[model samples]
Target: MNKLLEGKRLLITGAARGLGLDFARRACAAGARVVMADILDELVTEEARALAEQGHDATAVRLDLADPDAIDAVAKFAGETLGAVDGLVNCGAIATGIGGPDMCELELDTWDRVATVNVRGTWLMSRAMVPYLAASGRGRIVNIASDTALWGAPRLMAYVASKGAVISMSRSMARELGPKNICVNTLCPGLTLCEATEYVPQDRHDLYVNGRAIAREQVPEDVTGSVLYLLSDLAGFVTGQTLPVNGGFVFN
Candidate 1:
């Protein structure tokens, strides 16, 4: 609808479905050339094809956040194909299955898995894309965090810790990348009902809806507006900030 991102090229990771997919769609609609990268190669390809059919500039690439090689390859593909990567959306994450265990009962492997994908992955992707983004002169990076980190939700220890690290990392990154004119920020969304969140228990979902200021189930679209603003020129002066899109679930 609006040409907020016209002529910009944005690369989104973990874009096979859920919030990442919606971000790709919205960015494309906002006149951006989008590169949808995901570990779910087939699904991401189909999504990209669908967007192309809609007459949007969209393409798909395979990326696994845990693999440094894959991250580098995708960054190379984006540079060669998109030319200038004006923005990056790190939306890929791993959460425990429904009814995650308490930290005392959580497996070390599970903790490592979540940290590797959620924390390390975000770092690697950002590091790999710095050159391309910095070259754009007005680069933007939006890391998808969770409100659980702020609210200190119980049981989901690994995920909460991982996102907490992301928020801290975003601030440090903003300070480091500011000289390059690349704005880095983190967005914390409440428990959203999306394909990626199907593992969340219904009771947890109900709790979120009932406790929210809006008293509604948070959805992917609810967070996209903040994302658009962060990536748009309007937020040029905004960086190293964490904005919660959880409908008042946890007020700052």
Candidate 2:
């Protein structure tokens, strides 16, 4: 590893497993001190401990992205223990199960929950950590978005709306934080094969796979490199951009 993030402190949300975990592992390998947080406290702790045992500077925290209080508490804890955060990867999200509901049929509660975690959570997490990021002088933020937002997939209205909000929010944040040298960008991944995606309908999965130019399913690792790049010094001049890592599923 080139240690692109040497001495950097990163706080990644939804890192118990899947793509978030993959990002933590890669960031640590690149010499970052990582704070991996998730709603699943036990899993996050165990994963962090395992990484620590391997000589990685890793810590785990219980974080409920939907709760504003929890977001504040986690931010404070991270700032106190890890010093200023140089990077934040907002990878936390929620998916609407297939055949659940359409836009007109979608329940308000379900929409609220998805938006709370996927959209509001990203906003709150980034808001809470901005002070710390600003203090670092080289802050980097990578918000996880989805290709559905770009293509306007049917049936998954709430999820698509939430991710669309994330992409818009990232661009606004990037513009606002540019003066502080804080790079804010969005990473939109297609129908990736992860634990969360298991709930997606088979027809939907097939649609993504067969329609992709590459005709290959995406793995969690496929998105980590773009994230790593955005968080490194190499991306200092990049901001307010949405980088899709979806294997050509949706082209700009």
lDDT leader: 1
State the weakest 10-residue window (summed lDDT) of model 1.
94-103
| TM-score of every prediction relative to native | 0.98, 0.97
Instruction: List, residue by residue over 1-252, the lDDT tens digit for candidate 2.
Output: 469889999999999988999999999999999999999999999999999999999999999988999999999988987898999999988888865778889999999999999999999999999999999999999999999899999988999999999999999999999998899999999988888778788888888889898998899888888999999989999999998888888997
Stretches of candidate 2 above 4 Å error?
A: none
Score residue 73 of candidate 2 by CA lDDT. 97
Each model's number of backbone clashes?
A: 0, 0
Question: Cα lDDT of model 2 overall?
Answer: 0.92
Candidate 1 accuracy as lDDT: 0.93
Q: Write the per-residue lDDT of candidate 1 for residues 76-169, one digit (tens) a residue.
A: 9998899978999999888887467887999999999999999999999999999999999999999999999998989989999999999999
